[model samples]
Target: MRFIFSVLFFALMTFSLSAQGFNNGVSGEKTFTFFDKAGRNQATFFSTTPLEDINGTANGIDGTVSFDVTNIAKTIKGHVKVEVNSMQTGIDLRDSHLKSPNWLDAETHPEIRFELTGMKDVKSEADNKISGTATGNFTLHGVTKEISVPVTFIYLKESEDTKKRAPGDLLGVNSKFNVKLSDYGVQNDIIGNKVAENIEVTFNVVGTVK
Candidate 1:
């Protein structure tokens, strides 16, 4: 009777372990492109000028995201790169000045990039949407700073058509954050007067699983 009871207990433990084995794993890689048709990847800065607020946009934004659906916090990784010269503020002369040595120095630093380091305060929302604060390293003007960006993620399940073409899930992400221009050593007396010291950056990215 004791042997029979011991065998049953071992069988139950084995079943439990097997059931929990699929709880944590990494999902496939996904490539995300920043849709800039309507000036999506843009930065807005308020200044003392009465003319108008500066709106600089980038059309070249490309990145990748790897997510773990089971363990959302443990295996979320992403990196995005934007071309510095792609930024334009409408005025040709002003745009040229922005790319010159005094401002963003596009010739020196051609690319602005962000790499996700960690995430916190993650909350799952309705309709496959997830909200969280992502902490990452933002590099601009040859300087890197750690910034926390609030992001919303929406996961789209694979449909029959998607499976035929993309073969994986689609993930949409939106994020917004503010940064000080001085933090990246971007300070000039003339430009500072027109451009605000703080700049607001925003991102709307869509990713496809690999």
Candidate 2:
């Protein structure tokens, strides 16, 4: 009877362990640094107006995220930032103009950042991903505004493929949101109808944790 009880307990433990997925049963708060393989992280912006539409990409993306694997919806926190001077609009002249004081003023405000505050309306998805609305403070051109963005996060356990990108477990974040240039003290009218007042921004970044 004693032997049978021990076998039953062992089986239960194995079952519990197998039930854990992406995070590999890791719990509590884990910090994922975006600095590793940051070049692959991408951020883009699109502006549309009646006269013309323009789009640009910024390659300078890095940040850190701290969150509990067990309670991501409630405990996720971090900040993602993009270098203002790294923006490229295909046209070299326009790119230079964008970094000038009349534009983003990259010399003074080198980075545009989003600091996560809280999350809500979370839903679990397949492949160890979660979708939710994240409320955060977005700072651009030295001005900060409160905004809510729909974000999706995916966790990948360390493996051979993941090691190719980084050294540890990976956290993937994807989000797209709209921002009004005027809200951030950006003058959208200087370019005439070429630049829209509202711009759509999208980013996909992966951070890693050991």
Candidate 3:
């Protein structure tokens, strides 16, 4: 009985401390708008296979986030989108091929998007930051799949230094996740040799409170 009570007490303490660094006594829902500030917001995709490694970056990343610092795990929601045609693989010909009908069909699908529905396993880190798994519906090539992305969020209060970048408070977000091409109905010759079946994606962006 004593052991069980001790375990329960530890769990409760952990849950209480999870929000330690996230709150600055300000508690409310803040709507944040994400914008492209000279390509400050970006998403990159990488694929590696035995034959070759391919990587690409998309500079056209924009989105909005509705977040509440006090109730982060329950009240965080947002959507991020990357323009399909903006993806560049460093090679013009390969970039063209990647957007062609046989590949991503950029004409039919003009954007890749992720809609954040909720968060899980949230824990506060140092420097007013928090880490968690962001649960969202990821849309790619006209297909939508539920994916969980491990993400870190840093909240910065408004200040003179931040005004140089934008207005209001700033939120920095960094996320990394892997997706299977076949799961999204992307099947091609490049999957086996030139590109890996699974592609790794990284997203980094900052948002200004609205």
Candidate 4:
């Protein structure tokens, strides 16, 4: 009877330890959408022609983020996909040219993707907000490049509004970064002088726990 009691005590301790380990981290998934009324996703480009700047936006951006709240820097993984065909530069002819084979090749490579690789310089701030620099592989026009993006995020526990809509933990993210078109094998001599090679991209995302 003494030996049986000892074995049961050991098993209970092991089970308790396992439970603690599991509860230490919070795992969740979120599907982020840009077409929502509250979301915004856009890119800006500079043009020497008329010395103006151009703005293009995509309304069909969608993606998913899988996050572990307890280990944010290491266990946060996400992928964002932009529908190239859905992008518009505010001009019909210019938009067509931008999506042509010589530019983004939207028909062939219909999606621009970014996969999160790591996070750095993470700082947890007040109000459940965290700021960091995220490194990721950006794929555009069939070329892949590593890029670093500065991001700010806030985590919200389930509230009245979230319970009515999201029903779980909510995360809000904002990030901005720059990319060069020439680096992605997109070059056109005729428009090169008119349009700048570097583009600025911005992301405003809201995610909910699965």
Which numbered prediction scores highest in TM-score against the true structure?
Answer: 3
lDDT of each: 0.69, 0.82, 0.85, 0.70
Output the lDDT of residue 95, model 3: 84
TM-scores of the models, in the order given? 0.74, 0.84, 0.87, 0.75
TM-score of 2: 0.84
Write down the worst ten-residue block by lDDT for model 1. Answer: 17-26
The regions of model 2 sitting more than 4 angstroms off are 1-24, 49-51, 190-193
Ranking by lDDT: 3, 2, 4, 1
Which ranking of candidates, highest TM-score first? 3, 2, 4, 1
Which lDDT value does model 3 have at 68? 73
How does residue 147 of candidate 4 score in lDDT? Answer: 89
Tens-digit lDDT track of model 2 for 67-178: 7776776677888899998899898988888999988999999999999988877766754777789999999999998889999888888899999888888988899989
Residues 98-150 of candidate 4 have per-residue lDDT tens digits of: 88898889999999999987787776664467788888999999999998999
Which candidate number maximizes lDDT? Answer: 3
- C-alpha RMSD by candidate, in order: 6.6, 5.9, 3.9, 7.9
Q: Could you give candidate 3's per-residue lDDT for residues 1-210 as a string of tens digits?
A: 999999999999756755633766556788888876787788999987677678889989889998777778888889999998999989898888888887899999989999999999888886478898999999998899998989998899989999899888899999988989888887655523457778899988898898
Provide the global lDDT of candidate 1 against the true structure: 0.69
lDDT of 1 by residue, 1-210 (tens): 999999999998755433321232323433454443444444333343444566666667767766556445556677888888887777788778888888889999998889987777776564367778888899999999998889888777788865653555666778878778899998643343456677778776666665
Clashing pairs in 2: none
The residue-level lDDT of candidate 1 at 51 comes to 43
Identify the runs in model 3 with alpha carbons over 4 angstroms from their true place: 1-21, 190-193
